[model samples]
Target: MRKVILSGMLCCALTATFTIDAVAANSALVSPDRRISVALFIDAHDQAQYQISHDRQPVLLASGLGLALSDRQFLNNIRSIKPSDITEINEHYQLYSGKQSQVDYSANQQQFVLTNDKMQQLEITFRVSNDGVAFRYRALEDKRIDKQSPKPVSVVEEYTRFNLPQQSRAWLQPIAEAQTGWEHTNPSYEEHYQMDIPVDQPSTSPAGWVFPALFKIGNKTDNTWMAITEAGVTANDHASRLQARSPKGEYAIGLPMAAEVFTGKALLSHDTLPLQTPWRVIAIGSLATIADSTLGTDLAEPSAMDTRFIKPGIASWSWGLLKDDATVYSVQQQFIDHAADMHWQYTLIDADWDQKIGDDKLKQLVDYAAGKNVGIWVWYNSSGAWNTTKYSPKSRLLTAETRQQEFAKLHNLGVKGVKIDFFAGDGQSMMAYYHDILNDAAKYELLVNFHGTTLPRGLSRTYPNLLSAEAVKGFEMITFFQEAADKEASHSAMLPFTRNLFDPMDFTPTTFNDIPNIKRKTTNAFELALPILFVSGIQHIVETPAGMKTVPTFVKSVMQQLPTHWDESRFIAGYPSKLAVFARRAGDTWFVAGINGEAEAKTITLDLSFLQTMGGNIEMIVSDGERGFQTHKVVLSAKTEIKLQGNDGFIIRITPKS
Candidate 1:
């Protein structure tokens, strides 16, 4: 029934010969720089399988792809397979709202078109960069006599699986959600990470493991590292996690059977055609390439708004320091004055500001902050309800009209940004709401920050005003749990490689206080380095004006001038739950932070070659054991070894000496 055809698709670094069979075909593509390659083949039955390699060494085993629909039609039949398109994208796009000022988005693109017996089509598009590889599924309309939609297509599950070699291992954080009195099916993306976990091992959680799964492909130094994450996330789609598959297939893209319930209503996504899914990405290369991969942003849509008004900087938050008791104007003014004193850009006036201060008084506070040369960021509950047990405020911005009105009011009130909290989950309805809010927020010139919501999947790229998100087990957890500060050292070490892979984390960094009244587990130096170590478009650090006076003068200086984004980022040493060392350059100046997780002292050898040629003298500060916060004058060189105490941290600032 099908004709056999052979063709060749020439890529940037290599040419893949396509061989056609009675039912399927096979081909291969390589990364633009010739470091990575993927071999794709369709069997006689029309099922598609792909494998990845680095420098000619197999890194990813053969993996199948398909999507199952509720209509009893499996989109597994490869009706026809051939080269779709090849493009070379080389451009530097600026993020009006992100941690990095500019991003280098360059990749070589290739695609494969697959169709089923029902005449329906699914296109798999792949982009290979020098550092990573990404692919996404786009559902197309069937072209046969009765193949179009009005009678739409609904997908139940995506049958994409990640099969790994037997020796490979992953750094996993099992996804969990509570189902009953004692347990949950999803961890709400709050669980601690388990490092170097074998891929074949069994896990207890049925919901599977949280994505952005980092894998160590082999023992080689140059070519065998990989990180699996998703991009181009939309509200129209549900979250995807990796579940263990036995007997051969190592892991799979799993569908969460349960939905998130808000106000007693369950939220689930029923994706329909004319639909496209998020990009499933694999960053493959050396650890440095995998650590600093920007493929996620490449997979996300570009900025949809004018970003001039949406500037990125740090905000002095009131909630972490004063909590509910500080809702009044005087306390809020103290925060503003504190932010102003430190020359920080913004002051966040948290929840209940409306009820506590009222309109006439709130505007005066906004005016006062403006006079201090500081911007205002007010908090609003996205659903508009505070608590179920007590009286709740009606959601004023649920609809388009209300959102426009509310945003206009804030813009008129001179508010720079809005921190919207408590999203329902990753549902089509909620994701649609995100798009609407961002579109409307731009109209009022209001910058945005998402709190108590889903992890970023390149939304910040699409909406630069959407600055930061609180989606992980951040410092705030200490407010409720006693064990929080104890786990701070280890948890902090794991973030950069895992939770921070695809988005800016608002974990609302804490520097003034480690935890209320718990002997500070991490030293003052460690606390101080956070503003630099943690990457957020808006580094919302929690430290009151009075409390901030106790910090070292230079630490305060660095905090005040800390660039929320960077020109470059490099991973230096250590793995999850062990150590994390990194260097970031904002311009001529370089900032570096390193923290140790174990209880014993350890030394790290840092490579300063990135700062080479740009001659600069280094001024270093460390928080090792009881050394307190002391500055050391050290000569700048390519290699420097430093020691840290158990539960310690180190930070250094490099400036060119005249």
Candidate 2:
């Protein structure tokens, strides 16, 4: 049996509070007495310390039994404690190598320092505010540690293999193999992995696992962690999960929220926290829809927080993969046609647009697109030579002064936005360059879409016109490559909990047809649902006019009707690897999307209780059928029960009926 413990003060404070039953094991009550009885669970062993406190009040609860990794001296001291010395349960939480570590603590340290004899030592300072805490981790090379280093630090590549249960193999087969490694080299060593999880049981909530890995800073190695917080489906509830990936060296002091949420993963590090480093926070609300209504206004831009550079608008190349002049003209025409048909507010032209942007051919295309009630956007390669080849000196707009002058010229030509690309990732000098681009772009009133860059850091709040950025592996690669698809679905599911926590992502959506050679299991309906599922401010429904014609009428209708903004949002249900459901409200209409990562049929139902108070019938548009990719042909009035197929999903648009 799971043990529940309440401190004396907490019990006293909650004497006559309203009693709310645990609807499920994870559910808890926020009592009027200012006490919250969260269903806490932790797996640990030996001398490790785990405690939960509310508003500074300590609560000693039962912790899980497991081995603890700490300083060698500390472990040696605690080894003598018998199993009886610690509370033990019949069923102990098992610890798996590479699985997430369990550690939770709260501190009020003004400055934190981290170092290992083998690596560099860094320092960090924290500032607490009403909203939350803010801090930076910095990396410095220790001459002593550097001299003793074993090898010049390089990334290690690992491939994961898992034998799935026969029932779960169908969806698991595609992505059974993945290559993992860290891509960013910064304040610390970071690693990336691709893996899949299978869900085959029925329960109110699904079992979850935390994944751990080792990161080497100088000569010292620290462990990083990520967890699939929730999985599986439950009746009348949506599925969802939360995941965080950060350096293990700062796990104890770095990750506090990982413990606040009942389910999630963490990396444990015994060393001190690093100083002056910029960490990335991404929180996506839905798997298919990237926009989070609560993100920009309430979270991203808090008045008291430090301001970072911001860029706005969607990337043109994401919507139209134009490699040359002709493709650019063709895509410009398509954008014009689609913009008018879909009431799209802005269109972006990606890189290489200026190769022949000054010629009569290009000018005609721009004029034609503008005439069709569409705005044109051009792309530029940051710091690349723009005056050579098809993009001649005549079309070149170099230097800050020239850039501003050209912005005026483009504005005269009715250009609406600009997609900047090919930013070389170097040191702080490059960082300063990126910031300058954003500042200059703002001067010209040109919305920006940053490609091949760092993650967003709440710049959108300062510049509401800034739309989205592409830091994550997005849908464009799906057009020609199958290499990333297996992890794509799972990665999409993970974003809501990790990457999206920071700001909006420009993960261009709704590519209905697979490009020439790529392997694809997704259908037109699935494509249409992405705009409603992914939390992106500016959405891209990329398809050739001919390809668009081939899409099913219902799918096209749904894509045309999808909205980019929402009034409210909720995570109905899901785990990071199995399934995820998100419901968003845009005025009277509520749009909900359910995406599955596992193989096999699953049932999902949305609670209509929120709608009951409205006291009216609701119109529903649901897509689910024998073919997971096929659109649901029938339009029905609300009844509640809905079924979803494995590796498939549905989009529902509900409006209150008079």
Candidate 3:
């Protein structure tokens, strides 16, 4: 074991790990690969601050760190600072969801102990990994004080900051004001992103910005891409967002809104002694590294329950296209048959199933689907005083008893999962409510999908039963509004790098057929590419059976064989909100997919040498203008040129040579 101790004097260097016993004002913890470093120090004003750099290039400037408790300020007026020995951590974990099935995690960790003038002790721990860094804090009780019965302590505010460089650019989604949007169901993390804006720009939403926030620092030639988010958020903690005001490019953490709590629950977070906050993760590197990094899940708590009932597959959802009328028994039966015909594992019966389809008919439909080896999923309104959404099956899941009763009934009806929608914002109470629902659902062996909800924030790893969450402004928005459709290309392109980086996003991707009363902007090829491009545990596809009949046979075959759970994923090419290209593998087959988000046709040349080294046969399926597909066999080479039509996409499937 190696240690770097910081006592009272400032020290900065790029050296290998060695034991140093000296009084230092600052301590630098370098990554295992030595390419990333985090500096933790107490400044001249006696305030705790930190900095991050990649390859000696500044990624985040000196940022303040501390929090205010109801009793007093925690990190200010630091009396003494002591550092612990550096511990090397190397481990491997397996997950059934997200971009990869198995992950190898390596990091170097050190703890900083600080005591304020009030004799309050706070421990801040930093873990530096090759791809990025993560830090968290624990408020401890001082042994000198007389021990008494512990009482709840409120977290007044956190002063953590992420100060970007002046020239840095950002792509962030402004969180909606609580109780503002449709039926007071605002701040669902569904707002559109402000693409490639300056880091100093204030957010349009007075509430703040949502995570994971993407940024590009340094000059264009020497740019370092980064994303900021939090993980391992348990019910003991409240979820947070970026504060709206960023004075001098310094972004602070903001707690949830007053109305963001569950009805009759606390808005602020309260906990007893030894309070541990969630890990603040900053993924820093090239765009590829940012896309491929699993720091979010890497810092999260492992799965708590069995995953035998967790199955990853696609679902045929008619509500995205057919609306409320599609909830009828006949239409649902058609979708079940459609799923069976396409070899999909599930068919989703959306909102209003209780009144429209009724219990008797829904049971028959479930039995019918089961006979064909297909499962059924239903929807519910997270109804209470939280939102005024008039959807049916409401008020059935506001309490644990009622929620479990509903889940038990659904399990008896052969329902595989439940899509709970229209939740309140990210208050501590609502965060606990999310965990409650997942826990109750898991008891009855049911999968969970949250809509109109907060970001998963690595919950899929914590609870394997949680397959996906609809935090993005999904395809349902595109079907209802023309403006949303117009911005579809760019918004979809941004998700792979930002929203969908680690979480399983239920974007309800792909609709090759034209939507009613809305002009479809993305080409069929772009829509075709989505199934492979987007990663979701239970991908609820929006295309109808009639729409499927219009595509080429090869395209249909590719859709049928798409894998929801991937063995490995790599970023091949492209930029944020403009173009995205990715290669994902399942077993021995590889699926290379890309989309051009610009209005003009874009040409992309991919380096297929990595895939070629494995010796495989390739088939390229690309767009033929707006509504058709062009399929052909291609030879893998070092450089392969691919021309994508405006608002178009392509997918290249590689199989091991027989």
Candidate 4:
């Protein structure tokens, strides 16, 4: 029979006892052969619905928490559920039916266990080590529901709900505020708007799916209980509303409880509990590195994967993207010819080299690039159908499988890397897709450069092949967009504090002497200093081949000498969006770049204390003032102090004089 239970007992001062009376909800229902038990209790007196009841009988407030259940439906045709499956466990811990009883708690503090006459069992745990408490519950071995699916699988669904203490209004309010913030800033704007339900009248509100809300209890002054469903389930209907019983004797329905579930066998299935109350789980480090690393590091000490996979180089497109294929090929050859002269390791062939995916055209370019002792990196689209009417349909590697194969083919062709583009940050699904791409590319030993994508997040640590991500509003726009030049100074200063915290950023440094607009600032010398200023594994010396040939002697000298790897880094001065100074080390040499956003000059002294520890005579390469971004390169002797002007910058590379 379907029975509802109510139990309670009061402790003198520190402890409380709870006894539940099993009341039949439906007498005709038979108890399942195997059942899982889950329960929650509210102890705080401040909550509006601090306690729960059945048929006017007060249920036991075993702990300061509550329980609720959601009915999950299983779809027939789905295959393996990868990490991308968010529909079931949006952000809450989901318990899948399994024989394992070992519970793994996300945040466990206190523990409670109860079993009823029908073999129904419940386990509840709370963690309160930090400022807040986390409650988790698991109901096991419920009657299995049978469903006919195209694939063979067992389906089990249970009635899930939380048991809360009486008088829980104050504790519930902050939960409402946190939920509001979560919904407001949710990545899926439409989903957030649709999921918003009126707390008092959820029935009349528009029913649309949104992420589940966290259940809360207790007042801020004493303690607060917080609980969130693991990721997967969506809140779509009024069926998920939060029900509350008032302190005096009133019952009201609140907003729906947020919930998530997991369907695959790989998901762990145990109800977890903690020995204490209030616990904190923090994932720290650079957000960019986390974004880039498919396999995220522990919250602390996040770093890029080993640099052994990185083959430092210069690319052609970054130096110059030409309309004429022959000119581009000739320029590439010339760059290769001077590779030893400039200390560059690689040359890239941008888009349009391949007439088709398996065409001999790419093969020819690969052969030529290899003969020059330079590595070749080709470009490809993230996803797009090639148009034969406009270009060559045979050239497209459209599907994921096809792209994977093409990457392998490129690797076989001795292409060192591939540049991928046009990945708009769609949602969690797209994020998963990108992660898969990076993993697959790893198998082929292909270095990856992501263009037109979101900011990096140290994914390079997990996949060192992921060389750089281009999310900056950078120099490319300067030639066509007038606003680009105006914003360049400020944007450069802002990135180090914001984006660079994660991983290598592909800013495509050193665009000098090629500014189309005279009113704007751009020059060869400015470009020469950029490699030392920007921290990217793949440093691009972007300029026309003709421009490179025409570049001033001093500017060329600087470009040829800049180093890509660094041993140390320091932030010397300035605001995020104004002016800034940074010094990075590569062995005994140190490279410093200071940028000024305004048009006014400012003087600053170098803190060579770091160098003093190393004890060395510093040889300097200083490019400051308008000359910093000018085509004509100028250098000054080592000095204790340096002065720079607005909309200007400085790049200094110092090595110990032997």
Candidate 5:
């Protein structure tokens, strides 16, 4: 506990968390093209604050900027300010699998040097790309400190906040990790989304919302969307999310808390000082613009693994909504046989693979899968590496020495990857564990999928072998609630702009078996389009051999060719949270998918003027005749239109016609 110094009525939110008297000065760093800008300055009370505006409208409100430390350092105080230094950056890189294989971007940067009363220094740097703005703080160690100064460690709290315009709203869900081990996990992360919620009284939850929190910064007509989240999260620090300051307060950056899991006594991190926090990213513009933004991967640290080992493709996964028959050896071979016949790249052998009907049976399945020309992946309880807790079996991976041994054993067994599950928090230890596992997986050239863990912050870029993350309300939830299907269409529409914008999603698309009692949310035709709609490097489809037997052969034929990643991505037309249309290209062929969220029919148009500009007379593979997977060839034109019934989807393929 500490003293609370009384200051004048504090401006709400980041208006002025830290107070000291001073003359106000403001400066902005603009995008090279002058379209996006981030302004920075100190308030009358020397509290550092910043705001972002795109195309001349405020996207982020005036918010406080600083960190509170148990060490009592006032890191955001501005003793004196130097005009910001401006710099220009232009670069390009290749993604093993993404909306696009290559990305070209340029941005402008503005940096300021700030020092507190004690002469402790900190730097606030902002990068304003045409697509978004990201800011990070660097604590500069002062050499003038006494030799006896204790090594500065840990972040007690964060003052960084996003005060959205009152008219603006957010699409959010509570974190599942916070409720994982609790007595009642009612508000688990697996719950449905609360859409288009106003900022003033954001949500009913006391725990706040999760990352990639999508916010619409203006009225319906203004249509400016922005997501407030973090990126480049390293082992040195834990990841963070927005929490309402008061139950009715605006959102502020804070660590995840589950009471028992993250006791108030536990701070955000213990990394040494002179540290740089992960970037707080704001991807601006429309849902499509959010989907097209490169800031997420751009802000992430680059890959540390050989690109050769990173093979991202559609895998057949067990232990999800459907695949349960494979509990024993004989039945497991059928999945391998089907995977080979379908030409799918990988088959995941989920949990319980280590018991008596286990490794021996697993080896048989592994060898059988290999001959069938398919690779195998397995799931493990990451915590069990240390002790038996939660899903941790005695065979779990806990220590580095053990991780090495496990990876080696799996590697020799011909396992292509591992899905480490049940990471219930995002504290420093949890964050470090993620990093350590990524490094170890890299050594064995094993790709990874993180389940029951914090959202991926472009870790796939930093460690290319780390594939998809199942942190979203994916297809698995369909097995849990009847309402799951009711929410699917809008949820699918919202995901591209929200969750999938920054990280690849493992929605486990393409399921055909009807639920026992609940009405299926979408059509097999709509389901046919998911491989194109939801973007993930490893697009795991939840189809078991038994389930696929009942699916239409034509639909299965198209499902066989869903591209896991694209060479390019573009946002087409549609309203937010209602309807969405997306276009992606893998190479010479292009895939366009649309989802209709209404209870009645809706129509949307496609303008192929871009294709015409590239001078191509193409073949059109249309799926709009009351059948989603019905494929037909037609001469492509600059304009085409179609009508979709409520809760339905459609897809079209454009390939050049010689």
Candidate 6:
């Protein structure tokens, strides 16, 4: 047995374990593996702050933590702090759809009770894991702190700040101005990332930067990376973003815009006692550790509903390439046939389905898809004065009664899922709106795909029916303009380390054929690699039937056999916004994908040693020259050297020797 110190002088005994000792003014918490450590203390101004270090090296230095309630401030004039005894957490869980199917979560948790000069108390809980640190604020149930009954309080603002080193480089996307973009659908988390810039650099948009922000400390030699994001957001609270102005590289949390509400409903978070904020997660360590960490889902509440209805597979989409003209019955039927031909699972019919192909015709198309062993996913415009876009099926899902009615109609029509698009923002009301939809959709067993929406923030784990969300600047944007197409190579490379790091992104990637007017920069091989590179439960392929017919037979076969759910995933090599190579395994087969986003060629030593023991054959596909495909069959020993040209990509499939 081991002795552990708690509070100021209290002591307890437990089985031998690893834990940090702390008392009163200064409290330290270390991870189970003793790799990551956190220090919580009160600054000279009596403000609560925390710092983090990995392997004894500083990752985040002196970050502020507190809240500004409508009744009183909770950040300064701290009178006392009581640290709780460290608790150990070790558990295993399975996911229906994610980067990895099996997850083993282990962490050390502790709570700090802080009382200000007013004698009012606030509680902050910290959970330290080997991958990173996660913390959240809560209201205590102690009656001594407040004599009267607990009244509902409003969270005016959060004082949490992430202080990054000035030397660190960042890859962050600027948050869009709410209700400002086309059709007032801005703040949908679709802006291009400001890649590899200084941490102190001000954001282009005054609204600030979006979550899952990636930062590289020191130099390339150091190879230290840290990504900041939030998880477990509930209806009781609002989603948050980093402020635009980072004074001395310290990013403070910012609330949603004034116009971001649910039909002009509640904006600020208002709740009674026994309230808990979302977990502020910081993933720190090497690029591999950051990429492999499942802290986003680990900290989330477990699934309460049965997930037997959730299916992970590829989808054939018509809207991205064919635009509004493709929402007709004939086009949707063709895509359904295309999905059947590719052995895909679903076909998404986007925008104005109600008008373009009336309800009768849509039902007919759904029946036709069912005949072809394909499921139909119809689109909806989740708008009600939040956005002015005139997409049909709009205003039909704003309320629970109407939303469930629409879902029942779709279920009766044999539709498999609904793609809800164009949400306003991340206010408290909007967050609750999302929860309401997910809860209602689960009742009908309808899979949800959120387009023109915010980052998922681990919603898929809680609501397994939520398959994919289009929070990134996806494939549709490439067809709209030349500028967006030009940035595809670099932007795609940054995703695995940022936006797509912990959530399913409906980027609707891949189009082997040409866009109507834009000059597509990335080669066919690059397009082919995306289905395996990106992890989306329902991957909506943008390529049309004609486009699919144009690719090589082997390429079609590869697309047909792609896996949406993975058993495991490992980072192979490369950097953000430049090159990315990853290996994902599904069952006995492994899919290795790599992309080079730069104008020049790059060479990296690939590590396939893990597969050597299994004794497999490597079937590789890469750009033949440019805008072409080439296949190679090789055997690996331990390591292999591969080179990729400008705007190029490659995919390798490892199968057991036959």
Q: Candidate 2 — worst ten consecutive residues by lDDT sum?
A: 94-103
Model 3 off-target regions past 4 Å?
1-27, 144-146
Flag regions of model 6 displaced more than 4 Å: 1-27, 141-147
Q: Give the per-residue lDDT digits (tens) of candidate 4, residues 1-658.
A: 1112222221111134433323222210111211111223222231111122222233223322223323222121111111110011111111110001111222213334433333333443323221122233443343433222222221122222334443332111112211122222111111111111122222222222211222223222322222222211111111122233333312222332222111111111212121111111111112221111111111111223444555645554533433335435555566555554566766666655564323465576678767766777777655332111222222344446876788788788888887775542322333444566776777777788876554343355445576776655555655546766766676665555434433466777665554655346532333454566566667666665556666556567666766656555666665445666777676677766777655566677766565555545444444444444343222332334766656666676566768
Candidate 5 backbone collisions, by pair: 14-64, 20-45, 100-567, 176-189, 384-396, 385-396, 385-397, 385-398, 386-398
RMSD (CA, Å), each prediction = 4.3, 14.4, 3.6, 15.1, 5.4, 4.0
Model 1: residues >4 Å from true position, as ranges? Answer: 1-27, 70-76, 96-99, 146-149, 178-187, 202-204, 219-223, 244-249, 261-273, 384-394, 512-514, 624-627
Candidate 3, overall lDDT? Answer: 0.86
Q: Candidate 4, 240: how far from true, in Å? A: 24
Give candidate 6's whole-model lDDT: 0.85
Query: What CA RMSD would candidate 4 show?
Result: 15.1
Residue runs of model 2 more than 4 Å from their true location after superposition: 1-326, 359-367, 383-399, 613-639, 656-658
After the best TM-score superposition of candidate 1, give how far the Cα of residue 337 lies from its true spot, in angstroms. 0.5
lDDT of 1: 0.71
Tens-digit lDDT track of model 3 for 224-301: 899999998988778998999887778999899999988999777678867788899999998989999999899998
Sort the predicted structures by lDDT, highest score first. 3, 6, 1, 5, 4, 2
Between candidates 4 and 5, which one is better according to lDDT?
5
Clashes of each: 11, 47, 5, 96, 9, 0
My TM-score estimates for the predictions, one after another, are 0.90, 0.57, 0.96, 0.55, 0.89, 0.95
Model 1, range 1-658, lDDT digits (tens) per residue?
1222312452121123432121122345667776677756664455776777777677777677777655534345666555655778787777643446688888878777666776676777888789888898877655553244445445577877777776776787766553321122123466667777777775557767777788887542534678887888775666676874433426788765345433343244445555678889888877677667777677788775777787787889888856788888888888888888878889888777788876678789889999998999888877632223111123766879988998898899888988887665455556677788888999999888876666677788888888887777787776656687788888888788777866888888766544567656777776776767778888888877767777778767777777757777777776777788888888778888888877678877777776667776777988634435788765445677888888788888887787
